[model samples]
Each structure stands twice: as structure tokens, then as C-alpha cells.
Target: MASIKLNNVTKSYGHGAKALQVIHGVTSAIADHEFIVIVGPSGCGKSTLLRMVAGLEEITGGEISIGGRVVNALEPAERDIAMVFQNYALYPHMSVFDNMAYGLKIKKVPAEEIKQRVAKAAGILELGKYLERKPRELSGGQRQRVAMGRAIVRQPQVFLFDEPLSNLDAKLRVQTRLEIQKLHRELGITSLFVTHDQVEAMTLAQRMIVMNAGRMEQFGTPEEVYNRPATTFVASFMGSPPMNLLRHAPNADFGGKPGAILGIRPEHLQIGATGWAVQVDTLEMLGAERLVYCRMGDEFLIVRTDESLSSAPDIGATIHVAPRHDRLHWFDAETGKRLP
Candidate 1:
């Protein structure tokens, strides 16, 4: 419901020799109603940044504003933001409806309005049939929905999700992701999500911020971040089994010219009719897909092939592989920066 802004925000802990700076002069603006996701490794300060925006953590420097007004001095409650934590924080003894309505009751909201809001939220979250059930009676996914329902009832200017799906099993996590995406579209509320899972970030975010060691490394749409990674760290972090970055030369050895440090997605490497011969090392079977591990000039690279590649290359067999030139990503080996 509100646009969020952070101007040169920073955070540091301890002092002198023991000092550690987490966020350093981070500046970004989240437009109204946009679903933004902040992604990074475990200690990258992703959650810390979200907590600062929620007013849960006192920012060490810079200013934070919500809906065109500076809210750095305001408390979390005064900011009109609802946060859903990683753990479903429902009251153990409270029923679904009661859990969702607890915040409203504390704010001295009219009982009738609270009832209306909670009921509507339960209906939206498909918990209408289980409002009478307590937290102990619900499954993990259901409890997560209750957590989401609690946030929905508040109708806050912004929604904060702090790794809300990390606890769910893989199947449930996937299911909940779709539900969240649908809920965002239906509510059209600005949401800031924090997660370390690149898959989650890729699937959920319209635009994502990649953070590293408490500093922002890159900010862009999922496609831009994947296709044109800003640095080697991002290049390695955003992919499955990661991108194969091999130190090679633009010479006649591996078929044609190659750049300094060449990055190629596994799926981009394939057996071609005309290419340098590589001695296959191992083969990985992945149901609908397969991976061929091969060696070229003392370097290892993975080639992806669909289930029906017709003639699957055998292990220890010599085969020709051509790098997908158009999809090739180049980076400077020394600086780890993308090539211009």
C-alpha cells in the first residue's frame, strides 16, 4: 500500500578491533505494490535489512521512509507494516480465527470489524473450513497459511516476509510459493521478502536484490541477474549445480576462440557435430534430464542432455562439444567482474 525507500542505510556492530560492519550505505526504492525479494547467503544481512525496514532493528545510519514520509523515528506498530516470520508464530492455544484476529483486538478495533476482516482473510487463504481448529491440529502448511492470514487481516501499507517458507518441506514450499504469488496479485500490496534460496527468489521476485557479506552486490530483475550476472559471486550463486567457469583461452585448442574466464550453463554445453574431442568422465541420470561429465584440458565441465538425446554419449567415450557462444558469459579472472 506504500512505497518504501532507504537512503544510504548502514549497520555496524561492536567497536574498534572487534567492529564488524554489516550493511554499508545501501540505497534503494521499492515502488508501491511491487513484490521485491532480497536474496543472499546466510550471513549477508538480508534479514537484517528487512528488520530495519520493519523498524524491528534500529538503523545505525541513514533514513528510512514509507509512503513518502520518513518513519525512522516511528515504532514498528506506527509504521503500519505486518511481518510474517520464518516460524509460524500462532498462539498455541488459539484457534485459527482467534490467531488472525488477535492483533485487531489489541488495537481496540471494533469486534464486528475484526470478525469481518478475519473471516475474509480465512476465506482468502482457504482456511474458512478450519477456523475452529487450533494450531496443534493444523499441518505445517496450514499453519503457515494461518501466519499469512494474520498478516492479511491487518491490511497494512506493506507486508514483510522473512523466510516464511524455509521450514516447509520441499513439496509444501513449492505449493506455498504459488499461493503467496496469487495472494500478492489479489491484494496488490507492497511486499518485501527475504530468502537465501535462489530458486525461491527466481520464482517469486519481480525484481531481486543480491547481497553479499552485508553489502548489496547487485539489484535487477531475475532474468538480468541470471543472464548478465554482475560478478563471479552472483554468477556462481544463482544457478543449479552452478555455472561452469573454466579458465580458458581464445585459441584453436577447444574448437574456436575463448575469452579469459568463460562461464557456461550446463544446459548450454552440448554434443555438437563439429567440436574438440572431450574424454567423458561420468554420467548422471536425472529422470527427465541427464548430465555428462567430461574433461577438457584438465578442466571439468558438465553437459546437459534431455532424456531423448537419441545417441547418449557413453562414459570414457570421446565426443565433440561446442560452447553455446551466444549464451556464453565472460568474466575477468583477476577481478571477477563481468566483461564489458
Candidate 2:
């Protein structure tokens, strides 16, 4: 197990004025045995950053250190790290046992030791029964587990996962996520998981790093990022329906200072008698909750409510709504940064 550090790390495609910079001097300290997720939209450089840490991509500037050793010049094989990719990169011709033991065999480890390591990893991943099965014989989730098992047998200092759950179905994704959590608890290895899904980041990470447009948006626990976002991008990206950001309206007073954008989460808005009048545009009834899509003047809003409500407003009906006073957030209109 080891700590990972990125110090003013940067990446660019070309030189001079036409250079397309993708990562802009990101820096963070990940403690030993901590699970950190780098999350953002598609083109935000999260996967690029993960690949850089794995020594698969060259660093244009700054340093990357793993286990207190600077690894900017190290090859991926020499970095003491194992990577699990989005596609289950398993060999169709190899059995589960051989797949797990391949790395050890390449290093010329003793046959007995290789067998022991593969057995141990299989036991941990609940794949002991499938050791003889080839990749073609397994389900998508099972193949993913095999990929994870291959990494585990190496006992690497750090684990790098690049959207490892992307191929699984919804149910299998949830199940595999739990399996990963349990595996981390038992082994306690330092891990960095990269994904575009905010829900995955929130559920898996001890702390998450939010990225956008080649910049680090925020680094904090899921609760902190959801409750008090550092920027407008984070506020809009880290939630289920996302935070509602409305420009200052002349007719509405959100108690925000002048020239600030008002932000309210869907769950924080409530149907009330004294508040802004909204025209219902649509409604979606989830099993446990409901989403009310409405328009207040020219601004659209989504309000989450409990399913127990005896009556719901009809489409095109006017309804009153208000945001919880303490839960409201304010952001700078020009910079889209959260206002203090």
C-alpha cells in the first residue's frame, strides 16, 4: 500500500500557441489505503490523469510520485501499480487461474507461489469455483471480477481503475460495487478510480476529485461536494438531477446578494402556499419519490417530493414553491463560482 502524489502535473498535445493543453497543473495528496475517484464529464481529462499516474502517458510538466518515489520516468511495468480497464482485458484462451497467475509467471515466480497467489485472489473475489473456466464461459460481471482478480494477484502498491464498471448491467454494477468495497476493506490498498458517473464516485470514493475543462474543480468528501460545492460546475455535475442554477430575476427574491445566481437542489424545494408561482410542465413518479418539472417565469426548475402526497398538481396548473432557506446556495454570475 502507498500514498500517491501529483504536484503541479500538466499535459499538453503540442507546443507554443497552438498547443492543446488537456490537464492544467493538477495537484493532490492521496494518503495510503485511501480510495479516491476522479470524476467528470467526457472530455474533462479524468482518464488522462489516471493514465498519467499509471505511467502509461508521458507527463508534460511536474512530477508524479507513488509510494514516496518519483515515477515520472518509470514505465508502467516498473511503477508497482495494476490497472483494471473499462473493457475486461482478459485472454479468451486462458483459464481464470492462468489469467490471474500470468503476471507472476512472467516474473518467473515459483509454480507453488503462483498457485498460492492465484488461489488466494480467487478466494477473495469468490471466483474459486470458476478457476477452470475461460473468459468466454463467464458473464460480464464474472469477467470483470476476473480482471480484478488478475490485479489482486500482483499485490501492487496501488490500483488504478478506469471506468471498470462501465460494461456491467445496472444490477451487476451495484453488486460489483459492493464486492469492490469489501475487497478494499480486506486488502486496504491505495486506489484511484476514474469515471464519468457522479453516482459511482459518490458511492465508492473516500474523497472525490471533480474535474472540468482541464482544471481541478474540487477535491473533498462526497457530502462536502454535494452540500457545499466549490464551483458552479461542481454544483451542477455532482448530483442526480443536479443543482438548480437560476439567474437573478427582477420579480423573484432568493435572498441572495445582487448579481448572484441562486442554486437550490431538487430535494430542497417544496410545494408551499407562500412562494414563487410555478407552472407545472411535467411530472415523473418514481417509486419512492416524484420529480416535479415546472417553470417559474422563464426559468425551469425540478422539485423532488415524496410519493406519499395524496394529490399532485396537474400539468399546466399553477403551483407555489419555495426553497429551504438554509439549503439555498449562491454563485457568482460572471465566474460561475460559489459565492461566500
Question: Best TM-score goes to which candidate?
Answer: 2
| RMSD of every prediction | 2.0, 1.1
Best by lDDT: 2
Clashing pairs in 2: none
Q: How far is candidate 1 from the true structure (C-alpha RMSD, Å)?
A: 2.0
The per-prediction tally of clashing pairs is 1, 0
lDDT of 2 by residue, 118-170 (tens): 98999999999999999999999999999999999999999999999999999
Predicted candidate 1 versus true structure: per-residue lDDT over 1-340, tens digit per residue: 9999989999888778787888999999899999999999999999999999999998889999999999998999999999999999989999899999999999999999999999889888899999999999999999999999999999999999999999999999999999999999899999999999999999999999999988788889999999999888898899876888888633354443344677888888778777657889998888889888888877888888897864677889989888776788778888788887
lDDT of each prediction vs. the true structure?
A: 0.90, 0.93
Error of 2 at 189 (Å): 0.4
Per-prediction TM-score: 0.94, 0.98
Cα displacement (angstroms), candidate 2, residue 71, comes to 0.5
Runs of candidate 2 with Cα error greater than 4 angstroms are 249-254
Ten contiguous residues with the weakest lDDT in model 1: 249-258
